[model samples]
Each structure stands twice: as C-alpha cells, then as structure tokens.
Target: MDDLSRDIIRQKYPEFKEIPSQIANGTKYMPYFKDCNGVIDDTLIDVIIHKENQLCYKGRKETPTIDVLQAYNFDLLFTYVLSGWEELAHDSHIFLNTIGNPSINFPKPPPGKYYLVDKGYLERKSYLTRYHKIRYHPSEFCGANPRGQ
Candidate 1:
C-alpha cells in the first residue's frame, strides 16, 4: 500500500519528484487535517520506508537480500504546510512531533482561534497560552512520554 501510494503521488504530482529525499528514498507521503478556521487540527501522518539487507554464502556463492518496513512519522509542520492553511495568523500551536522527543510548538495562529492537539504536544503550551486566543488540549496522551516519571 505504501509503495502504491508513493507511485500514485509521483504520477499525479510530478513536482514531488524534485524533492531530493523523495527522489532518493522514494518519497515520504503525509496526510493532514485542518479546522474550519484553517488551523491545523491533527498531526500529519507520514509513511516511511526502512530498508535492510541480508547476506548469504553457500560454498563459493554469495547473495544479498533486502527488506523494508512500512513505518510512520508524524510531523506537525508538514500538516499545516501541506494543508495550505497558512492563511491562519501563524499563532496557533500548529506543529507537533509524535515520537522521540514528543513536543508541540508553533506561533499563534490568529486572534480568534487556535489549534487543537493532544497532551503529547506539551512542549509549547507556554507560548500557546500566552499568544493564541484559544487553544484546546486533549485530555489523552497520544504519543510516547520519554519522561515516564
């Protein structure tokens, strides 16, 4: 499915081929969600491919094998940018990282609206509260919490 999606994107949007990483690693595609006010409403879900190799030797013969893992990476910035929601005032907590260093941060979106996200996006609350006119934090944590304390 991941490969099929990549092929479809490449066929539909030739410009994607220009992206260096896309050309090399066969494009990482993401899906984004936005609110009525044009603020980003969810993390961008991306499909990433992991490659590995295996080596085998039989007497005087040698062979190599390859493997792939269909993994996902969620990037906050990719959500807003891909959704064409830049019309917002750029003051909302529009971006979030769902893994590794779980964090969320972005400039205020607009005077009357803000982005909504989960608690995993805790890194930027201070700024969101101060500048964003309104922000919604979901009660659940949707990503890993490194500080398990």
Candidate 2:
C-alpha cells in the first residue's frame, strides 16, 4: 500500500500482533490458530454519508450513515474491519464484494474451522451464520425445546 493508504489503515486499526488466527487458550499458539465466530458484525458510526437521504425503519427515522464492518474475538480484539460502505448497502453484499474472491483477501480458517455469523451472510463453507427459520431469542426459547436450543 502507498503511504496515504498505510496511514489511513494505521489510523483505523490498532497496532496488533501480525498473525493469521489464534486460539484463545491453547498450547499451539501459532498464526491461523484462533477461532472465528460470533464476533463478526457491522455497526454504523455517527458520521453520515448522505444528509437529505434519510430513512424510516420500524418506527424511527434513520439518517444517512457510514457502516463499519468489524470482526472481533472473545477478547474483543478487532481481527478484521471494512469501512466506508454506505448505510443502505446490505451486509451480505459487503461480504460478497470484499470476500468473494478466487484469491480470498480475509484470513483463511483451518480445514475444519469456520466462523459463526448472523443470518445476513450467505451459507458458505467457512461461515456458520444463523439459520433463516430459527428463533434465537431467549423469550422464544422459554418453553421446552426438543432441538436443544
């Protein structure tokens, strides 16, 4: 990357140990050894991309926003991030545009490893996203569940 890009990235990400992945607590503390799960999600920062193009969702009026797609571990360390996406863009679209490549850009998991994600992502080999027809909330799971929720 050029100096400007490097500077931007430096500002966006913290100084971190360069590794593929690491298991939280294990003897084999090597790169690509970490678990990728639940920690992947996107949040909108206050900065707006569009001023007049506001949206109304549910019951609230939503303003234009800049979305930050972040991935963290159990320790809350950011492993991956993608910024500058418009608020109206879909999460799956962002993932596809950035990650759907013959030469994958994101960190690769081990043979049997996969990530835990929400329903926004497509059902893929390396991601374990939430199912479409399941109730994951505690209230929905109050009664006896034969599926062992």
Candidate 3:
C-alpha cells in the first residue's frame, strides 16, 4: 500500500529527485527517516479478555481492536511493523514493551537519522515529533486537499 501510494506520487510528478524529509521549504536535514504512525484496527473478538478494559473503544466501536505500528521511508515503503498488541494498551506502553527486547527491536538508525513519529510517542534523541496542536496538513490551509471530503 505504501509502495502504491509513492508510485502514484512519482507518476504524477516525474521529476521526483528529492522529497524533503518534512517540508514546504525544509523540515529535516538529510539522513532522516520518513513519517510513521500507529493506528487501531477492528478485529474479530475472542471469547475471553486479557484485561477488563480491552473490551472496546469509541474510535473502533464495539469490536475488539489491535494496535498496529508501521514505519516508512522517504519513498513510503514500509520499513517495519509492530503488531499483536491489545487495543486498550497505551501507545507509550506498547512502545516500551517492544523496544527493549532484543528479539523485537531492530538496530537503531544511524547516528543522524531519525524517525518522525506522532505526538503520542516520546521525543527521544532517536525520534522526533511535530507540534502537538499545530496543523501540519497542507489541506488545512489550501483548499486543494487530496481527500476530496
């Protein structure tokens, strides 16, 4: 899906030499990873619950859910996927449970490179996040939004 999305961008704009890490002018220096985020997806409910609070969330309605974390590169190819976590788990908790374990966490990015994450994740030396309350979406200001909503 990420590949398909990137392909469409290249197709529309053939002179795709450089896409800034994050920028209208410039938001990041080179040796940086692209944006990545977590999302909750509805899944078939099991008869039992691991925790009482894992029942359901408003965002996902009454169905059980799983939190999926994915990372992507500048070309929007998926670099990683961390999943199989309960829906009610805090984003930070899910992250901590994954990173410290050798079998799960991958090697750290090279010294200067960092992954852009959502505000839920901590602002560590290895990762960066955008302003919490700011509107970073281009469509917010320009009516030429792609969503067509």
Q: Over 4 Å off in model 2, which ranges?
A: 1-38, 49-60, 101-104, 139-149
- Report how far off residue 21 is in candidate 1 (Å): 41
- Which pairs clash (backbone N, Cα, C closer than 3 Å) in model 2? 21-32, 21-34, 22-34, 23-33, 23-34
lDDT of 1 by residue, 22-59 (tens): 22332222111121112223332222223342221111
The reply for model 3, stretches above 4 Å from the true place, is 1-60, 140-149
RMSD of each: 18.6, 8.8, 8.8
**TM-score of predicted model 1?**
0.21
Judged by whole-model lDDT over C-alpha atoms, candidate 2 comes out at 0.54
| CA lDDT, every model vs. true structure | 0.26, 0.54, 0.47
Estimate, for each residue in 83-138, the C-alpha lDDT of model 3 and write its tens digit: 55666667766555555566664334455445566677766765676778776876
> What C-alpha lDDT, on a 0 to 100 scale, does residue 66 get in candidate 3?
59
- Winner on lDDT between 1 and 3 is 3
What's the TM-score of each model vs. the native?
0.21, 0.58, 0.55
Of 2 and 3, the candidate ahead on lDDT is 2
